[model samples]
Target: MWPASMPGSILHTAEVPAFDPRTGQLSLASHDLISAPLSLADVFPPEYTLLFDPSPSRPYGTSTSAADADQPAGQSRRKRRRLARPDETASPLDWIRHREKEATRSSTDKESDEHHAAIEAELGTAVEAVRAGWMGKGEDAWMGESKGRYEWREKEDEDVKEELDLVGLGERFAPALDEPPEPLLLSESRSTVSAAALFHRIVRNDGSSCISLDIEVDASEATPTSKATVILPPSSGFLLSQLATWPASAPSIASLGGEKGGWDVLIVDPPWPNASATRSSSYDTFDPYDLWKLDLPTMLGDSPTLVAFWLTNRVKFRRLLKDKLFPAWRIQQSAEWYWIKIASETGEPVWPLDAKHRRCYEGVLLGYYVPLGTKVDLPTLPQNKVFLSTPIGHSRKPFILDLLRPYLLPRDRPPNVLELFARMTLQGSFRRSATDEDGEGDQQKPGIFLAVGNEAIKFNIVDGSAAAGSVRGWLRRQEDTERVCAAEEAV
Candidate 1:
């Protein structure tokens, strides 16, 4: 059914409106922000063990709601529990009782309904406007190809098994080059000596549209893990491939944050321990307090950095970011936003606004960060905003870099960004990766922008070729290794 309200134009803005009748804050379409040119394995079951080296964990301290505890020796980091909903799976009599119980709490129900109804009205109208703009007026509309839900639009897929052993790619590294290489750093190593050599084989290109990149992440072996080609979604797709080789001269751990004069923007999405996970074998979450180990303040660039923290609906997590996390980093929490998951066909939130088990929206907390002594002026932050996107892959969020671009400092070039605890990625990271990394002075004009993550690239270990056959994953990085090596030998 068509929405009751006619679609209106959506204004993607940088500054928060003093007061606008239509959706108090800026609302955007997630789809338009992340229109990747190719299809990709939307979700890669997180294997936290293989990510880049993390700072040494700090001594556990006593804090309320954030106890210092460790996962049992032989257990997984994620916790799982069952949610019993009599309304969804209960017997006819039980269902009646559940409904009756709800009716008995009239005041409570009325207040909740009224609150959510307002959210629905405002958010729904904004989403329809943006979605319609992207879907277009007629024949060029994206939805024309699909009468039902788009196969690519759904958030998660059960059949795409993500088992991988990246080490296998060592065999595919480009044959030892005959000439001396450029300066290289050892800190970028993946797993072991073999993995480091494999990383050396990675090839990067900052010239393409940054809409996408084709890297051969071969997962070959006799066991369950085999070789498979992957298609990473836009921005991230292009950025991660370049990040694979960007750190040839990266600074040390102590220098990571300020070395580049701190990141102009930092997007942190901590995988807080929760009962809801696509699969138990996916990401490894930690106690909320452990996030302190990251020491984010150290990661900031010298200027004001915009921080976007993705939060679950849980109030405790919200409190953690606003009260504890923000204060710790001297970040001034400014506004709250929402990322609503909608159905591709209807542009309606996939779930009811007030669903008890889970709301159709996730909360996003935005803030401006400047260290205690840093004197950079902060920009006015946006308020009460929401971006709507159809879900894809496991917890894969829409690429938000472009949406956040307006707030980036300098306004001349893109912000130097950091994606802390990033998984599949904070979308659109790669769009600017192709730019010269010689810092703010580089005269290179901005082309397109994209994204990357700590564990941004994943290989399923199945046998096959990818769409971009011209690209070779086996390309080698020409680096001047500081350490001596035995003469190259056959694998």
Candidate 2:
């Protein structure tokens, strides 16, 4: 049974300071802005005893230890046959067999060629626009001529090391399930939804007991327990609910501001399908066309709304965003940015600028929604900019509030923000991760509404280590200003 001290209501409400309209800048008061590169383990520590490394160092098509053994017999046998082939060469029979299969598959797949050509045409136009704008920016530009070759072993080694560290942590902190876990109280006056209320249990899956949220559990009957308590920083505020619940919840969230109507910023990171993602069995992927059906435009406020989309590099997906999705949403493409994955050790790209198989960067498409006949002066958005960072965990992108601050609406107070398909929870009062080593204290605060699927709630808690060394420069400048103010007061 849970303690009576825990709130009975699933939702808690707290008054947060409104964004200062004069600045048009995002408040990072709740976020630890220390600019240090963090390891994958630092951002998302091993919560369960079983740690599974999805990306292994095995040769292409070869099965790793983590590969599912229960695959169909035919598939397993096929993979085994491929593995049994000689390293440097294939038998003439094997070559002939592969050629026959390819020929048969190609002959039957005529529609694929037409689809590829259509996507290629759309991609070529977008790339040409980018090249035209960045042509004179010189070699220092992100789109500068690439050498077209890379050595990816270092990055792979780093991934392996991080994976091992997670495994070690899991082994060290394996939870005991013989007895009921103790209930943990996470108290914060500003948190509208407590972490205790959001997560029901840490269950083991495939050997590891990572932090998992049982959203299916009835909130009224839930008696959740956590291994640790998390007190959130002041600037954090989150609403924990399934993505389907947002339409019902948005009106209430908007009503909090009386006349705000809807959100000023909408950020979405949909789990778009890809061949690599399909193979890994990570999160469930959705069809790109299904995105067009979402009633996203209805959530936009009367004022100009900023919409940022995290996009995969597939040409077909890009076309869907530009042609189908944007048109349906009535959003005009303003600019595009790249999230470049760099090495934590050397600060260089994990893969070279032009890796043939995989590029080291992902795309972010930014757009704005404007109602008809609404004329407003907006800041010119920079094009083709690169945001550099070492990625942590699967598909966990960098937090770009600092980079996005400049372009946010300059209303009287900070623009209200909203995130769809959100993984990371940003709310008033940021919570420290159990694995955080810096002993960073919490601050009370507020943020925008977040809507995600049930599976995404596990990543909603704050990760203090994500910014580690990355924010030090910015933090130092802030401290220097404070020191000068203190010295002046003393005089």
User: What is candidate 1's CA lDDT for residue 461?
Assistant: 19
**Candidate 2: Cα lDDT at 209:** 15
Off by over 4 Å in 1: 1-125, 128-162, 165-193, 196-262, 278-281, 424-454, 459-491
Where model 2 places Cα greater than 4 Å from the true spot, the runs are 1-235, 253-262, 427-457, 460-491
N/CA/C clash count, model 1: 28
* Local accuracy by lDDT, each model: 0.42, 0.43
Encode model 2's per-residue lDDT on 362-477: one tens digit a residue. 77888887766788777756555445544544776655554566676675443455666765443321222232234443222223333343343334332112222211000112
How close to the true structure is residue 58 of candidate 1, measured as C-alpha lDDT? 21
- In each prediction, how many residue pairs overlap at the backbone (N, C-alpha, C within less than 3 A)? 28, 35
* TM-score of decoy 1: 0.54
